[model samples]
Target: MKNSKFAWLLSLLLVVALFLAACGGKEEGTKTTTETDKETTPEEEEAAVVDEEQVLNLIMTAEIPTMDSALATDAVGFDLLNNVNEGLYRLNQENVAVPAIAEGEPKVSEDGLVYTFTLRDANWSDGSPVTANDFEFAWKRAMNPDTGSEYGPYMMSGVIKNATEISEGKVEYTELGVKAIDEKTLEVTLEKPIPYFLSLMSFGTFLPQKEEFVTSQGENYAKNSEAVLYNGPFSLTAWDGTGLSWKLVKNDQYWDKDTVKLTEINYDVVKETATRVNLYTNGEKDRTSLDGEYAMQYAADPELLKELETSVFYFKYNQERTGEKTPLANVNIREAISKAFNKQDLVDVVLANGSVPANYLVPKEFSFDENASDFRDVNGDMATFNVEEAQAAWEKGKAELGVTELSIEILGGDTDLSKKMDEYFKSQLETNLPGLTVTLKEVPFNVRLDLDTNQDYEIQVAGWGPDFQDPYTFMNLWLTGGGNNQMSYSNPEYDKLVNSANNELALDPAARWQAMADAEKMLIDQDFGIGPIYQRGLMFLQKPYVKGIVAHPFGGDYSYKWTYIEGKN
Candidate 1:
């Protein structure tokens, strides 16, 4: 009996030991599997961090309304379309016009009245061959009076043959200067020589559109990403009609795809400064613009960037709002309002950026004459602040307006900076001009533009950047019945000066400069057609890794074709 019990005990002990060894092996295998799942491969580790070289993130103050080249009137739309569409030429990193869809420089006639362009072998994003017919269709569509294109009539008038006539309903759209010689060749005849023709052709207004696609989309055209076709280095994506965010992805079909380093560009509309700053701090944004006190706060940041541009901001007093005959119609009231506010104080206190007080409409840097003198220097300051003079003018204007107490609404932008500046204007104008009551109306940028266009505001705080590199760019805005002249202010003498500058005096550079200078003086100093505020100073933050982005004075705001990110991973 004792031997039988000992045998059973030995067998039980051996079975228990075997079970323990099996369990140990299972645990070892389980630990190895878990570690394998947790560990990342080299490729996986690389993707865990942002690939800065392939992606760019940015913020804008407002949303782009439309990407259609013909209808785009704002800087945001122009900038967006400039990236997604290619013209005959494009502004390079140096902002010099360079061949884009064109094979090379256009063949020009001796008289400089005609240009012939040969299209390159290129395909749109839809894989359709880009031909000269596309250019012809797009140009005619822009010139067609029925298209209701504001820039087309303004840009081509007095430049392209019969363009002015077509715009004025005296001729057919087919009479416009642009024509397709063949599938590959484009011929353009000019009414006269335009010295800046090539640069003008590089603008968004000059980009080509496919006839069928544009017709098919019709009213829905350029409202979203799918509504438009792209022939540039990048193709727009993920843009819902009114969304705040969108993406620009690299176009593999682009002729210059090899040169495009950014695979994706992400843009978000962030109007609030605090939100923009927060995004930048969180590494969610690679760049953001700063204004007012934010400029001062970010001035100490190592990544801070400052760019003083040719754009100017001013106040436009509308004399044609529907409800009432405004006091702005009286010259004495306009003059009083123009001189009531201290521009230096506005720039120093409200702007706080590097922006300079603009006493004149045209900015100081560009518009040089044969003597190499700046136009602003020749005209000197057009408007200035003088409380005593303003009060005296206001008293005189009160009698002229037949109102002892004048209440006016100042229309302004909805941004925080815009509000601050508008408030400052109200305070100063009310304080300086006795018996004047000021009200404020702040709205979104697009709404403000519409209000300005309809002449539906009493006083508008407005801004304009150069569309081309000329003093005439600023001078032409206030021409009688001009497309961009939202204000009702008009002077026949001003019209005469601008016409002469663009016509007979065009060949005479010195005379043209003088004419523009005189016109500016008549518009601002003598007439007070608009109140000049400041030349904008942009303060922003750019990551050290970002490179090769170009900020142009004319055309679009930035050229990101060569932009790339580095050191992200």
Candidate 2:
């Protein structure tokens, strides 16, 4: 009985020893598998450390009016077009005109009247080769009178050879001096030597459009994202004509797509200041413009950015609307309104975005003379605020119009900030200029643009940013019967001065500069065709991780070609 018990105990001990050995082997095998699974390759390790989605979300104060380059007249449309289409040149970080589609510098004629450009091998978004014919077609299409392109007639009329004649229906569009020498070469002849012609190439009015694509779309050309063909670093997407939101995706077919970093960019039009601020604070928006109280609140924020742009806002006095004369037609009345408003108060109290009161048509520190002196410094202030002067002018204007009281409507934007500013103008004008009843017409940005185009408003609050790095952009708007002269402002002296600046004075740098300065003075100080309000100053919040956003003083307001998302997961 003792031997039997001893054998049973030995058998139990052997079984226990086998179980412990099996458990130990299983644990060792599991650890070996885990270590192998954790092993990372070089590429995998780099990706793990640098994993970030290359997406950007931004805000726009107004919706884009149109995507068609030739038809776009506002900053929103132009800015969007700048990203989705490549011109012969594009403005760089320093506001310098850099070669975009053109290869290096152009071969210029001795008289500087001709420019021969050699295009680099490029492709449209459809993978078709971009030829010089595309440029010729786009340019001529703009100049076609039937196209009724505002910017086409305004930008090209005086610069390109036969542009004015073509726009005036005096000559065929083919007569305008732009030709495709070959598949990769283009020749452009100018009416005269334009000092800022190279910079003008970067303007939205000069972007290329594919002939086949544009023709195929017919009435729907450039009406939406799918209707347009992109040739730049980004392709516009998700825009449905008048939608409030849009997206820009990297164009794989772009010539320099390898250098593009951002995969996608999203844009939402948030007109309300509170909504824009909330979007920025909640990390929903990467950037937002701050105005009024928001501008003051974020004055000390680390992410706050301020830029004094070369844009000028003003009151456009319409002499006639729908074939009937308005009270603003009287020079004294225009001058009274011009000098009545307190521009300093408007900038300090309402804007508070570092904006400065502009007493002249051209903003300071923008255009430089041959001696590098600012145009504003040389010309000094004109038609500035003077309550007494304004009252006296108002009385004289009333007598001239044979009226005891006069009522006028002022058209402005429908945004919260615009409404506030317009109210301030109404109060100031009524308080300062007696017997003046002001009515405010608030409309969307696009509606305001249309009204201005149709000469359908009495007095409109308008603004102009430089299309190129020249004072002509601002000065030429008041030219007699100019395309942008929707106000019926006509002055022979102004036309003569501007024409001389671009023609007889083309070769004489000093004379051209002085002529432009003189024209600006006449328009503001003498004619009072437009009342200078303030120079634009932008204050916005930007994420620290959002990098390489190029803000330009001229052309498009911003460029996202070099922009990218970094240090954000």
Candidate 3:
């Protein structure tokens, strides 16, 4: 099994992906923006709740690192943005795109190149009206290159016209895909029509910002609770940039202020599972992630379990790190490592709860293939380990490369399960691959992601959940130009398949499914750069007191917003 070479095949696949993105006939049917995102007339002068007197409390397992939407890129970043800012559209509980700051679904021009937005007369937490240029400023700033924003591509590059060009220094920043029609309206031109456009807006990276606020505060903006603006239902009450915990209180100035009932939300950022579960049981915290062995006991107590099929826990090989990445350059050696572990057994023994062992490139629950069950035999994978097969591969690989007793380093989290998995991976590789030496290192969860983005480690553990419902979410990671594709795994045919799917857009459902399926198989069949661990299982629990919480597979994710607490204000 060999990895596909995407960097070489990108020219062809990029063209195909472009065609798929523009292939579908005009969609008069994209998700509509939420009420807050709608267009407003001057006569609608009702002042939104901008100065709330009441505060809410929220307890979370993580702490937010940055308040600046452009700079934030992880769970903490998203939590911060979802609470403090608003997008033109929001993902609903059903994971469908709905209006937020826009008046309605974007008005697509007959040519399919232009999109017009009617703005909602919403105000920022600072009492300034949110206008089209607020978005304009944000978009331009995102692509400015000098902003040091890691999330810019996640924002404009794929869907918006000229976005990729501007970000790549191929065009002027002013020429990027968006423009302000007036103070109340915005226009967007996509180089290609994208089915996933509206859904992409729901992400925190696309949240709006006020130009004056941004420039005035400079680096100080989003540095603390008082430095940021609020457009969502709540505002931070007791957080500085340094707090281990914070609070979210109702914002009286919010557009839908009347509907918000939870008066105060207390948040505590607990990274340790034992500490988190203990807080929940000791009544020190209202909500938390249950640790191993505790999940079963808590489940029998009658609380419903909530789960999301996020992709997998994975290790990425950074091929571009000069001295730290040569072994990763050898596909056979990489394949030997992939064949050396049985992650399913690890999950069964270590996870022992909601998390499942993943072996697929894309989560099974995500795709929509009619013949998809028949593509290239899903059961066939190089990752299926036999000690003999592993040894054979390792022996052949080492002989060809002329290496003896190699030293390899792997990084993961400090979790008890992670520690065991690290040990398991080490033992499997050392035993199966003769004369091989392995080293296991554990870091914090957030620190792992940080290292991943920096491509700082040789073999580092990581995972990615879908940003939207499209198969592109998984496939995009392999694209030569993709941000998450840090492994340097490349294949021309695989890239061609992904590009073909994008070109077709929302048309020819059968062909679309097949394209994504073909791409997944090609990548997985190669068995290097990535090892399939398990399809993620969604699992969580809520108090009976909470209601109306949106649990859409693709929605804006309403566990924090749409849920209502009975008898609480």
- Please, what are the lDDT tens digits per residue for candidate 1 over residues 1-569? 00000000011011101100000000000011222135555455344434446899999788776788887777787777778889998877666678899999899999988999999999999999899989899988888877878777777777788988887899999998899999999999988766557656776777899999999998998889999999998999999878889999999888888778889999998888889988998999998878787888877877777767777778887877775667898888988998999988888878887778998887776455667777778889877888887888899999987789999999998887888998999999989888999999999877877887689998888777766546676677888887667778889999999878777776677777788889999988889889888777777777766666777666567768877775556
TM-scores for all candidates: the values are 0.90, 0.90, 0.84
Q: Go through the candidates in order and give each one's C-alpha lDDT.
A: 0.76, 0.78, 0.62
Is candidate 1 or 3 superior in TM-score?
1
Best by lDDT: 2
Clashing pairs in 1: none
Worst 10 residues of 2 by lDDT: 19-28
lDDT of 2 at 514: 85
Please list the residue runs of candidate 3 whose C-alpha ends up more than 4 Å from where it truly belongs after superposition.
Answer: 1-59, 370-382, 415-417, 504-508, 552-558, 567-569
Residue lDDT tens for model 2, 229-276:
999989999999999999999999998887677899999998899999
